[model samples]
Target chain A: MPDAGITAFADWIATTSLSHLIAQKLWAIPAIQSVHIMSLAIVFSSALVVDFRMLGLMSTGQPLSAIARRFLPGVWIALIFATISGLLLLIAEPVRSLPTWEFQGKMLSLLCVIILTLSFQKLIAARAPAWDAMPGVPAGAKLAALVSIVLWILIIFGGRWIAYHAG
Target chain B: MSITEFLQALESTAFATAVREGAILFPFAESLHVVALAFVIGTVVFVDLRLLGLASRNQPVTRLTNDLLPWTWGAFVLAAITGLSLFSSTPERYFTNTFFRWKFFFMFLAGVNMLVFHFVTQKNVKEWDNDPVPPTPARVAGALSILFWACVIVFGRWVGFTL
Candidate 1:
């Protein structure tokens, strides 16, 4: 984020009723936790389906496009929840997280994954055969998929590592 | 007593050096452990969602399980071996660690929950063979798997903090 963007976000978070809402009760914390946990299943469900298909577990006859169409919604939903709950968790400890280089690094990687997800949708689903068939997914396409999975795994590892090396 | 002595006392059968040095083996067992986790967690999420009516609208539950079962066993093996080596490194802490204990409890529940799904619910699977939605037993198993896995992850996270 730009310095201006950071300043603006901090201002909005501080000035809004969101601060008071999160502060109102302890139950809110667990609610945030539940959202975080539930989203894991959703996100994993979507990714695994596509990965399974890629690995040729199911829907082999169906084009990769159809299989991806079959599961991208859950991925989006989980990303949304993961984003919201993640933001709430970060807000709960912005003072500490803001300067934490690990947090910053994770955010950067996440940005890369999201950009890749958007930039290469057709390529990702290119296996589906519904697309212009672009001949076949380039090596670049497979690299993007692998990169996406690695990013998610790294983020999870980073999240777990945060407790140990919070700074 | 020293940490080494304490860990040795918890599981006296093995040499402390042999046990704690799991990273030394760096062999097939370690590789299997990782592959197993991918299978177990990966299939669990997919199958659980199907229980909740999430994906693969036309696929059979049996077929899905048959495809994924090998991986689950793989994960279970990795977790078991790594878990053993992991415990050997710090048995005393794990024995008394609240989070570690809860993780064990949840892991046990996950196992039993899975077993119940196989034995009690296996019969009912055919009943819902053509049905898109699984029966309540399968749904309950799915819910428990999610809850149990979540607890396991939390405990795993908390272990790093508390220990």
Candidate 2:
């Protein structure tokens, strides 16, 4: 069983006016969901390219910084959208959302994803020129890419299960 | 057979039975589908963005497409497999859903958009391959492609909720 604090929080969210409005509106959930999914595509696609480069899978001829500079804007923009939509979805039905194991798991993965992405970006920025010249990226960089991929997969896994598990 | 019959037949198959009935299988397939979609759309964005003259301003278009298209094709195949699996689980519902229809229609358009670029504008690709911005035709193809795929993603997500 979840702790008492989580249950109380879930109870409080269940009574919110926003949650009631979301439940009443026919189009609200689907519209928000569409935006969320599109944001997923944008964020994942931009990150996938950079990660692919880190893994030595593609863009072998280009420097890491060169490719990253091209795609990071898309990533950041999409991430902002994803965060907003995700929060909207959460507030729309936090009672249903908060009690679920899927939500709990998704939050964990999301936390890891943010940390990994930020740190990896920092690492790339710090060693931009040196990393670009190397034919093979550092082992650490590849490991970060792999970990980021795995965390996202976990996020997707938990996300797809949220509805099924939600109270 | 009628269209409904066709879809029903698809859903009635042994594979579909497993997909629909197996608790773990459906969600697992969904996760796979999301992963594949990320790769397909992600790689395609590079080509589209480059054609738009938005990113990778210095890279040759041919070089970018050559390096990226292979991975895109690979991911496309994976997406098709996972997508088919998802469809099989609820063929009748999906067949009737407007969102699903829009998704496929836009997917077809994206395919045609790519073909036109490959066969027509790409014929003279050598002339503008190194140009900071590609010519009008190439840019149009890129822009249309981005539009079609964006619609595809929007519709694909809507299908889940609508169904």
Candidate 3:
């Protein structure tokens, strides 16, 4: 459950003019959500490409660093767009968004995945050539890739469940 | 029977009713649809960008498309199946919705663009396989693909609102 302070903040946000504007405008929420979903498609797909490469599922002929360089920047850039749209959604309905366990879980999972992705990128930057020279991807890198994919899927579930599970 | 009657029947079927009224079934299907769509669009965009000479310029177009097409096809099948499941739940509602109809229109355009590229434009892929910039027809196809898919997503999102 949300604490008193969080509940108070949500209440205050609900009373704001922005919330009222969003509530009155039928197209606003869906428009914002469309942007959010499109950005998420870019981010998730980019991450999948890098992860698939790490797992030797595709593009095994290409160097890992080359593939990561091509796709990982898209993940970060699209994430910025998704976050901005998500914040607009939260502002529009703070009470519905802030107090939900599903929302909280989504944030936590997002944070973990971001950290995992960053560390993976850092490792690649430092040692991609050494690892790429090896006959196969290391066990640890493949494990991280699997974890990254799972966390991303979990985050997607949490996002959809928020509306259904919210108070 | 007429198309409308067939859709009405589909909506009233036991499986469709179960999906419509069940607490989790609809949302689960929607989430799966979204996941599958992300991969489909993502993989398609990657290839399109390559064709447009916007990204991954170092990699050969043939190699990139060949590697990514399998994931794209696999995810596209999942997306279509889940999309059908969602449509079955309220067949008439979706069938009559303007945005829903537009979504299919754009999807059809995207498919035609792909087919033209495969049959005509790509007949001589070897001519420009390794070039940083593909020929004009290939670039045009890539641009059309991006535009068509963008329309599909926007219209698809509007369907939920209009529904």
Highest DockQ model number: 3
Model 3, residue A156: distance off in Å is 1.3
Where is model 2 more than 4 Å wrong at Cα? B1-6
lDDT of the candidates, in the order given = 0.64, 0.84, 0.90
Task: Specify the highest-lDDT model's number.
Answer: 3
Question: Which pairs, if any, clash in model 2?
Answer: none
Q: Model 1, A1-167: lDDT tens per residue?
A: 46556646655665557766775655565567556755754665466556555545445555667657657766787789888998887676454455455667778877886676656555654434443233334565656667777776655555434434422
What DockQ does each listed candidate score?
Answer: 0.19, 0.63, 0.76
- Give the better candidate number (1 or 2) by DockQ: 2
Query: Candidate 3 residues A13-85, lDDT tens each?
Result: 9899988898679888888888888899999999999999889887887788888899999999999999999
Which pairs clash in model 3? none
Judging by TM-score against the true structure, name the best candidate.
Answer: 3
lDDT of 1 by residue, B1-163 (tens): 9876766576665544465555443223333333345446656877787776666658777766665666567657777876666566557777789988898899899999988988888776888865688888888898899889778756754664566
Q: Which CAPRI category fits model 1?
A: incorrect
